[model samples]
Target: MTAEQQTLLEKSYKDFTRNGALLSDEAKEELRKIDAALAVVKLKFGENVLAETQAYQLHLTDAADLSGLPEGTIEAAHDLAKSLDKEGWIFTLDYPSYIPFVTYADKRELRKEIALAAGRKAFQANEHNNEKNVLEIVNLRHQRAQLLGYSSHANFILEERMAQRPEKVNAFLQDLLDKAKPAALKEFQELQDFAKKLDGIEQLEKWDSAYYAEKLKQQKFDLDDEKLKPYFNLAYVLAGAFDVAKQLYGLSFTEVDTIDKYHEDVQTFEVRDENDAFVAIFYADFFPRKGKRNGAWMTSYKPQYWKDGQEERPHVSIVCNFTKPTASRPSLLTFNEVTTLFHEFGHALHGILADTTYPTLSGTSVFWDFVELPSQIMENWCYEEACLANFAKHYETAEVIPMALVDKIKESASFQEGMATLRQISFGLLDMGWHGANPSLIEKVKDFERTQFASTSLYPDVADNAMSTSFSHIFDGGYSSGYYSYKWAEVLDADAFDFFKQEGIFNRAIGEKFKTNILAKGGTEHPMVLYKRFRGQEPRVEPLLKRAGLL
Candidate 1:
């Protein structure tokens, strides 16, 4: 235990020095002040974004305004309006309300209005605007990087990631861009042409993309999210994930109501090994609420570690905002939400399986680029017929998802994958453009973004809209120069899952190897070494490219 403590202390001290602790006493004092100010500024930046998101609302009294929205969406909107003591539907910037409207609403003008509102979230001239905040945040980051003897923020951040420098990150993104751009352009042209044919619209704008793409997908695959939702009820999907975990790792989960929960929607469970020994505590919070933030993520309240000759267990939680259960139905998840649950459950499994000696080096503390491999790889299971057979059944009828629908899901897995890859690459490139070089001379955020996006730009630009102002991942979150890691980890995940595919998907030996080698080991060694130890070879990009149909 003492040795373990010593190791953690050493790592913490090294990290502090690597950040800026070796500076002169005066410089160190200034660094402290800068960090304190940065904390306040970042907090304010996120708060401003949330406030702005909550502040805007499109209150509708006419049925025509709600045209083309899903029935579930209309019901939710009516509930919101009733709660607010209004007469008709109310739509906010929340994704549940916003996404369906943009994707299915027939009123292009309304879609344009909501999309423009979403895009220009913190870019407005109101008190919640983030223009000055963005400038100050980036300048402070650059200043901190220089103070730490790095040329730029990307250089400082990438030092600890799989991609070790700005140039390498840029090259990785560009290589993917070169492969994906042609296909992406062709896909865009097809989408535009489809919109023209379907609605007599001459040009398809950004707001029209999802609506048309969804329509086109239905036309091609004869599969839609609503048609698939009945088989993915939230409770059953959670059970499916647990079953997969059990089959893969010999773990079991049982709901225990005695544990205190933070919210009514949260479910608590006791995890156990095959021997019935306690493993970890898992909490799941699904469904959207006003207080909780958007997006799904896994977090650990107590990390698994060893001390005093005893192994402590972990408490892991997965939070998400799925479509809430309406008055007439259970909480049925869209196909995308099913994959999301699996993704986050994968992260929780990482925490639950942690067997490290030191808390600091425990689960999910690996390299930024490597941390996503487990989560993303788990998503692959959702597309498998073997896995889906366990828990994918209709909420009312109890009928399993048809083999035909499963086949369609697999067939359409890589549909328009090139365009999707290009979109992710664009975000990564934009992140690099901000942090890879000096942003000292960039006055207008939109002007700088236009240049960064020049290579990836497809549709006509919206003058009032800017992405940088609300790009929380790079600015307020830990992804500053690390957005590319999503793609970076995709490569790792594709390669890793290929191993499972080689052996049977449910091969116990392979599952045990993965749990012990990758999830349990955490940040104990360099990520590349850990990954190679598990896979027995360096990962090849061909697997990822092939999976995405880029090959």
Candidate 2:
């Protein structure tokens, strides 16, 4: 082997040993059993959550109870009820149906009902309760860590992450908490006062938060999502995202009918380089249905790699539970959904442009915190006027979004910056609290979460609702202690985009440098080394703070 290859193999050997390959045969056997059991438990945990989610449905026979919900939401709900041979409207815990009801519905009691139903998923006394599953999962994780001679699960995982150790992750979360607390408190007070004046809301309950926040936002900025959705038809926004990629990377996408798709809702495309060479296969799946989970994300069917003296391309897919089109309208996306599309597409670009050799270390195989930079940075373009002008045209009139509305959108970007930052910091802290130290003492899930979330608490605690029960990120998914990566990557993205702003949003030379240095490099080297080679320096928090209006 070459010297570099030999060195990498040596490091890999050390990694395997440190990760438990060096354990005694008996200990390794125990670990294998623990892993098998834990896998089943984790699968059960996720399935229970989904079952609990699908189990509940609110059937509203009174239009009065549906007051303040948008026309589109009502139509969808009506369609749902009709499909079930029921009357009036039906709203479930699905985000597309649930978010609008909780955010815009004026019926405080019903909103509380919906919110509690959501938060109470897998928490109640039922076949799908996750309380026991959570306890067993954590215990098994701690046992596995101990078998491997690690202090905690976080300590075991952080060894491979940029943060390196739990102490560093703790310090990082604490620092952000310290900075965000003051502003968060102020924002909470203002929101409470606004709620009181607007609706005589006495307590500002958990359910009241989103409803009032939306009202206050509209009152302050004279803007709401419904007013913005008409300009963000899914087809046009997809084209716009593609255009942005083409502008930045000299890539082109052509829809192809021959490519096989796992689902009919999925669209397939052939991606090509500037010289018209085949690059990657892209698949997009939008809209939600039964047997499908909620939310949005990017995934890969095949990894890019070099084998047998040839480079094998990748197949990338982005899946989202966007609002489905109805008889009256196309699938018009909220501004938040627009940014989500850009974020996932950014990850797609990372996969599409991967120029690495090893499949295990290729395309988004970088440190968890560093993996979000490309994705989060793409969100910035959604706010740019030129970017918006390219595709934010009304579906009916074909007129571009008014500059006035764009100004409102930009102005509202940081409307509740303080509260939002604190919410994120709270999640990161909660994650650390769970995984960074001994969690064997956490007897009751809700009580433990209350203690961890004490300082960051904004809304009044609901007796029946708990976040940990449904927090699939740490339990069923890979995030575990790495939820803080979202904030960490925000800092990187904010600083990186500041560079783009200094040059120009679509500057070709700068884009090429970013592509060659960051996007194409993947996990071939240390993430910090690759990042510094791209940015010419370490990232700065000042840029993120400034963009968040927290500075």
Candidate 3:
């Protein structure tokens, strides 16, 4: 907190944007010392993420313990429990175990208890409490940003994004909120009305959101995840994504067993061009466990670049929190999760297929706003008829998805677009509320968070539950003030998809242009230039608005 200490931290940053490869020989030596301290801190960081994902499992060895579980739940429980030296079943913090229990567990008290158990993490008086660690991380980040001549962390980060600066990010978030507020209000009213009528519930609580929303969606569209999940077995869904990529870009993938992986669950593949030459290595890690985080992300353990007279192939991994395969069933994906897989894999493809010369400027390492373009645009392919038929098939019958169901999926594509946009904008604004301002005057973190959510708060804040205490993205993760990039990239993705829709979703000319201009170029040039080179002009908001049915 001292000025002298702050200056030292700032000086060490050396400006990430201006300085290419800030880790030079001299800098690397200095960083070796910094890394020593960072190794200690990051060790705790990695351990906490792993512990949250892997540790503190629930072991139920008795068959009766699986009483209320869904069809395959008991099998998954037994398999997991047996592995951990139990009799009946094993349950951990994996999405398959945790999320279904949270949303559909018939036992309300059990759900609440486990929910509290999960929420209580990193807040209790123990080393796992990330509160102090979070504060330290934020302060360190502030110092790093200041070193780069930015007013705040948000300013430093957004400057290189499509949103350009904190001011622009704030403006974009607010502008979207202006458009989305009415739709959100209408959606909430409808959900509340439905809850009152169907469940005779006069009050809606935090727990009611997902449950009731599923109910409303089923009533409105005659569609629910369970009915659709049968058609979205993992291999089919991945094939659907692969088919879309091939149609759109002439890219191909072949399963390869030669590569080394950190875990047995990971499946490795070799990406290739139409001529069958090697492109990149793609690792897919699907399932929830203590070792993984709670969301989906695309990460490059090895980046694509030119070094030592050879272009190094990239290794891209897509880590997702999906339900593990139960005893009777393989992992079945909800349509939304299918889109998410497509999104992360799109990011993986961007990295794996990268043809760049510099590591810093490779794959999805472009501007924050533009980085989402490939991933988000790939979600578009999920809706195409040819695309779906390629991957969407009945798990048991092995029949391709019915065309009528594909039609239903497309019709429901914009079903909750307005409400979804509202949620995304609200989070981005919340991010701005924190890093965009001076927190010194704000002593209470909970009160500060409440104010940030004031304009968008649908459910009353649970006094015992504070989101800031556990918001890993803005605190320990790199998002901070840049969380708005999701929506920011939506604009780019939607617009870019329009170009493909005009030509053909799989037009090779356009795909090659995009590969050369956008994916392969990375951060070597301004994102706008790369975007325009591909789209032949600047991206537009109209396409996004149209896609969201807001127009």
Local error of candidate 1 at residue 26 (angstroms): 0.4
Tens digits of per-residue lDDT, candidate 3, 1-551, equal 44323433443353543332454576555545543554465556546655654655666555554554566556666677777676776666566776665555555455566666566556556667655555555555555555445788787777667677788888888888888788788888888899899978787766677667777787887876778889999878888787776766677888888999988889998888788877888899987755467888989999988878987888889999777777568899878889999999889878876776667667877767778888988999889986787778899998988888888788888776777888787778777877775554656566777888888888756765666556667765668787888898889898988998898877888888877887777666667867887888988899988878787
Q: Note the clash tally of each candidate.
A: 0, 0, 11
Off by over 4 Å in 1: 1-10
| TM-score of structure candidate 1 | 0.97
What are the runs in model 2 whose C-alpha is more than 4 Å off?
1-11
Query: What value does the lDDT take at residue 77 in candidate 2?
Result: 94
RMSD of each: 1.7, 1.4, 5.8
Q: What is candidate 1's lDDT per residue for 356-467, written digit by digit as tens?
A: 8878899888889999988999999999999999889998899999989999999889888989999999999999998888889989999988999999988899988999
**What's the TM for model 2?**
0.98
**Local error of candidate 2 at 100, Å?**
0.7
Model 3 lDDT at residue 241: 80
Better of 1 and 3 by TM-score: 1
**CA lDDT of each candidate?**
0.89, 0.90, 0.74
Q: In candidate 1, residue 408 scores what lDDT?
A: 94
- Residue by residue across 1-551, what tens digits does model 2's lDDT show? 74335535755786787657989999988988999999999999999988988888999998899889989899999999999999999999999899999999998989999999999999999889999999898889888888888899898888778888989888888888888888888988999999999888777888988888888899999999989999999999999999999999999999999999888889999999999999999999998899888788889899899999999999999999888889999998889999999999999999999987777767887778889999999999999999999999999999999999999999999888889988998889888888888888889999998998998999888889988888898899889889999999998999999999999999998899899888988777777887888889999999999988888
